[model samples]
Target: MQEEFISVWVRDPRIQKEDFWHAYMDYEICLHTNSLAFNKKSSCVRRRYSEFVWLRQKLHDNALLLAHIPELPPKNPFFSLNNARQITARMEGLRFFLEEIVRCPVLLSDSCLHLFLQSQLSVKKIEACAEGRSRYTVAEAIQSSGCRVQRFCSEEHSQEEGETDSE
Candidate 1:
C-alpha cells in the first residue's frame, strides 16, 4: 500500500467587495498531496467564510452517523481586516479546520472536500460537480474553472534538502 500524504494551508486573506456595502474576507486554500483520493497534486482556491460554513454543514450532514465534525472559526459580524489579531485568529482557525478534516479518512473522501480544496466552484456547483452533473472532474475543473494549480517540489525531496541543510 502506498503511504498517503496530504497537507493544506489556509492563508492570504483578502477582503472581497461584492458591492460598496457588501464585502467579506476571502482566504486562499492551498493543498499538496500524493494521495490518489485527490485529483490534483497541488491546487489552490479562494473561499469566503460563508463557503466554509456550507462545507462544514455538508460534511456534518454526510457524516453525522460516522464521525465528529470540527468547529469552524466563530462567525464575527464585525470582523475587520484591518485588525492583525483578528486576521491571524481567523486564518489559524481556518487552517486548523482543514488540517483536522484531512487527517480523517472518512472526511477526506468527500467529493465536496475535494472540490472545496481544489476547484473554484460555488457551493451549488460543487454539489453539482460531486454528483457528476458537471462536465469537469475536480482536476479539469481546477484547470478550467479559474482555480490556481501550483507546482511544488515533492515532499520527499524537500525533506531531504532540509536534512542536508541541517547537517
Candidate 2:
C-alpha cells in the first residue's frame, strides 16, 4: 500500500485594509488542501498569522524540534500592504511553511499542527488543547520519538564543498 501524501498551498491572501497602517497588518494565512491522499476531501481553511504562530508555539511547548517547523517570512515594516513584491514573497513563505509541516512525520501527528493544516476552524478559535501523552519539549520529543533529521547545509557551503570535493 502507498503512503498518503498531503499537498498544501496558500492562495489569494487579502490584507485587512483597516489594519494596514497599524504598524502590523493582518494577513490572510490560508492553507488549501490539494489532497493527494486517498479518500480525503480537498479543503481550504482561512487563517491568520497569529494562528500559525500559536501552532508553532504549541509544537515547541510540546518539546517538538523547531527545526521541524518551517520558518515564516520576515516582517517588513517599511513595505506597504499593497506592495506587489512584498505580498508575493509573503505568500511564498506561507507556502513553504505548509510544505515543511507536511514533510515532517512528527509534525504530521501533532494535534495543533494537524488543525493548522486540516481543521476548518476560524482564526479566533483555533487553539487545540493537549491530549493523551505528556507533551515533552523538542529535545525530549526527539529522543523519545526517534525522529531523524538531516544536517542542513546552506547553498553557499554546498557550492564550496562541491568545488573542493569534486576537483
Best model number under TM-score:
1
Estimate, for each residue in 17-47, the C-alpha lDDT of model 1 and write its tens digit: 8898977889888887888777677777899
Which pairs of residues collide in candidate 1?
A: none
How close is each model in CA RMSD to the real structure? 4.1, 12.5
lDDT of 2: 0.51
62-159: candidate 2 lDDT, tens digit per residue: 64464456677765656666688886787777777777767766665665565454444443333422343344432232223211112212312344
lDDT of each: 0.80, 0.51
Span of ten consecutive residues with least summed lDDT in model 2: 146-155
Q: Give the TM-score of candidate 1.
A: 0.83
Question: How many residue pairs clash per model?
Answer: 0, 4
Error of 2 at 45 (Å): 1.1
Q: Give per-model TM-scores.
A: 0.83, 0.59
